[model samples]
Every structure is written in structure tokens, then in C-alpha cells.
Target: MIAAISENDIKKLKEDLKQKGYKLTPQRRAIVDTIIAGKGSHLTAEEIYDEVKKLCPEIGLATVYRTIILLEEIGLIYKLELNDGCSRYELANKDEVHRHHHLVCNKCGSVIEVQDDLLENLETEIEKKYNFKIKDHSVKFFGLCSECRKDG
Candidate 1:
């Protein structure tokens, strides 16, 4: 909850934008800060805009949408679609070779991030049998979380 965006992170992001012929404007920085601060929450565009607006009252919703697209394109963030109406986003960790999976509680609609890959052996077997290289994979499980199970 106490997530802090380091200056190095902002600098790196600025450099990434520079390569794409963009600059880290104040509004974009505020958006990035909001996303970085709430990295694990998997915020939607509207939620991000709401948070960013507190810091930048002049920011617009369309600007948040555009910035989200640009950040995702630059690999600074990852988009997550839960088959719901809205899309969510989380900051992309620079050191992550493979993204983590999510466990969604059907009863409560709560999502828990599973940090382990847990599919190395399966991926290896499939790659060897199919003669195809694996790039990345996402796995989501729908079930009752502990709290929901207890409540039930």
C-alpha cells in the first residue's frame, strides 16, 4: 500500500517515451504516479483518472485513456481484461520474465494475484512436443476465496 515511484523509474519511463517521440508531461507523470502507487490494485482507466485528477485538476478523461494506451504500448504497463465490461491495468515490472496469474473469487468478485509461475514443466513439455517456443502465458482461476468460503 505504501508504494513509492522512484525517480529512477520516472527517468526510465521518460527515456522510453523519448524513444517513442513523446515527453513525460506533468499530466502524464501524474497518471503514471497514480498507476505506480496502485500497481497491485489493477485499476481501470476511470479509477486512474479519478486518482490523477486529485493531483491534476485540469486533467481530462480522454488524456488518461490516451496515456494508458501509450504506456501499454511502451511496455510500461500491462492490460488485464477480466471478461467484465472494463479493462484494468497494472504496472509492468522490469524484471518480470513472465507475468503472474490471478485467482478470482466468484462469490465475492475479489482478485488475488498468484506470484508463482507454476507452469514451467507444462510449458517445457508442450514446447518440446509441439516444437514451438513459448513467449508468455496468462492463467486465471475462478473460485471462492478463503473469506468467501468461510462466509458460505
Candidate 2:
């Protein structure tokens, strides 16, 4: 797939960083670029830090943590805390459909994005039937994925 980080998006991110007085250091920019380079794939901070190391080996792990936290604070990305104790992050694409829910393979820890509007509609119906307003929510469907099922 084409790299998810488009020139327009990077330009906008640069502008946002500038307005916030966040220093656009080479390492920081490279880290962002690298993260976006992964496109739809969610990556942990350690994975990101390791990739950044190839480009700038001297960069510290703490620097990656700080930068990711700052970026998340600014709403540039979404941080997902998996039950596995590792946090995976992906760039926030405002124009696309929100990939909010997940289908998790309990055996393999494989996460698949579930972008089903029907599920949302069902939730809405349930809320209306119960005479309650539904706020934000997250759903994880856990079962053995195809590979795991085949293995068993």
C-alpha cells in the first residue's frame, strides 16, 4: 500500500507542531514519518524506537516515549492499550471512516479492525430502547482466529 503519510498530511503536522512550539528536530520528524510509513499497521513504542534507531542510533528510548505522548496529547494519533501490556499506536486520519472497534484473537493476540456501521446502529437502538444515552464505547471480540483454529 502507498505510504499513509501524505505530503499534505505531513505539511499540516509540521504547521501544527510549529504553532505549538514543539521543536521539529530531525529525530522527532523522522520518528513521525517512520510511524506514518507503516500505514494501517499498529506499532508499539518499542517497535517505533527500534526503527528510529536504524536511522539515528544515538536517539534514546525515552525520547520516543516523550514524543509519542506529546503527539497523542495533540490528537495526532490514537494510542491503543492492548491487554498484552503493550500499547500500539496509529495515525489518526480524520477524513477516513473511524476504525474504532477491534476483533481480537484470544489465542494469538491478533487484532483486526472492525469497521461495521451495523454494530453502531445496533448500539444506538439498544440505547434508545433502554431510554439511555450511549457515550463512547470500545468492543473486543475474543476467539481463536482462523490460523489458531486450524492449529488446534
* Best-fitting candidate, scored by lDDT: 1
Which residue segments of model 2 deviate by more than 4 Å? 1-4, 122-137
| Predicted candidate 1 versus true structure: per-residue lDDT over 105-129, tens digit per residue | 8877788998888999999999999
TM-score of each: 0.93, 0.81
Candidate 1: regions farther than 4 A off: none
In angstroms, the error of model 2 at 119 is 3.5
Model 1, residue 140: distance off in Å is 0.8
Tens-digit per-residue lDDT, 39-114, candidate 2: 5678999999988888889999999999999888777887876688888998776764544777788898888877
lDDT of each: 0.89, 0.79
Residue pairs that clash (backbone atoms under 3 angstroms), model 2: none
